[model samples]
Target: MKGVVIIPTYNERENIIPRSGGRRNASQYGIIDAVHKNLPQADVLIVDDASPDGTADVVKQKMKRDPKLHLIEREGKLGLGTAYIRGFGWALEHGYDYAFEMDADFSHDPADLPRFIAEIQKGADLVIGSRYMPGGGVVDWPAKRMILSHYANIYARFGTAAPIKDMTAGFKCYRTEVFKHIRMQEIETDGYGFQIEIDYRVWRAGFRVREIPIIFRDRRMGVSKLNKRIVWQALFLVPRLGLWNLWR
Candidate 1:
């Protein structure tokens, strides 16, 4: 399936548009550029959540020069999941073959996007850039952060009984068929909980889901949108989402 990478941005002024030298965390800088540079054929959709720092402007500027780049400007700061849902609708309407969920802040490696697109082309309905798997890992984080992130995915899999290793992984590719099977309006969660909910629905619909290993690098340009409350909400919501399937 032909695909476009949907990058959700919220106050990513530091990294949204390339200024002189732009933002970098070394390894992260390399991986993000890998896809933006090498995968020139794929379209990139940026959904900016009303960043005051003119993040959308930067994208607009880039859009003038790059046909692959597109932007959707929202009025206020919306959550990550909602921005992606919006982007997905845009992609589907635009006749894209595949839809992707990624972050503009660089947490999810862009270089791994090609792998997800490849999986979609190979007939997997969904592909994830996983961090907890054998070849994948989180770099530059301390033990506690690693444990929380690792076990969160573990708990998500167990709670939702999802076969995939990393249910909460944000970097994912969905075939157009998968999007067709699911109800976008039915999605209720706006934060981290949204990740598990959609994946659970995809699984319930009997779509193939696969995980690819990727070295997740830390974002050096901006503050993380991840919060303690959202973490707690995700901890509580995964099993609830499993139960939500019955209602659907």
Candidate 2:
């Protein structure tokens, strides 16, 4: 099965730098290498939002060497949702059977790429890498942040009634058919809310969703993009989607 991993980036130069330690080390190069190591058939699409830190340059350098590496350089710092949407469109145009959403900061493990594909082959339309599920958890996060994430998931689940344990999960694999059915142009939420919104839409469309336990490690390099505005967006968007679902 042909698959493509869509990694959205914004100033991820440090995260993508090649380090000599090991595969456990976080870097964009490490992510691409790990994905190929685990699933050689899968390709990577780096959707860069005009990173001022020369992140796109790094990807271009690698692209010259790796034929499977693809890139889409946007003009500026577009939101996360738009970045992934652009990548998803590219994946579809290229005829990829499966499309994946992953982080460039290495918070999501590349090793699990194969596992997601395995689940997709088993008839799952959307496979989520869930940190809230059994045998799944986060590492090195502060208690306050953990509490916020945990409750955010709870709130999203209750509000959307999406039957997903990790409503805010960013790491996921989707069968191309899911996107073919959903109206992508209508999705507006960005940041973490983007994850919740997509999951709710897919569930509402009656697709089979599956969750696989995954350990989410905080980014070892660079700063996180989470902000108060993002938090608020998610808080309001969940109930809005819920009400929309009921109305429909």
Task: Report backbone clashes per prediction.
Answer: 0, 1
Show pairs that collide, candidate 1: none
- lDDT of candidates 1 onward, in order: 0.77, 0.89
Please report the TM-score between candidate 2 and the true structure: 0.95
Lowest lDDT block of 10, candidate 1: 25-34
**How close to the true structure is residue 178 of candidate 1, measured as C-alpha lDDT?**
82
Candidate 1: segments with Cα more than 4 A from true spot: 18-34, 244-248
What would the TM-scores of all predictions be? 0.90, 0.95
The TM-score that candidate 1 achieves is 0.90
Residue 197, candidate 2: how far off, in angstroms? 0.4
Error of 1 at 89 (Å): 0.4
State the lDDT of candidate 1 residue by residue for 1-113, as single tens digits: 46788888887866664455545544434222545774666788888878888888877777777777888998998778788889998998999888788776667766666
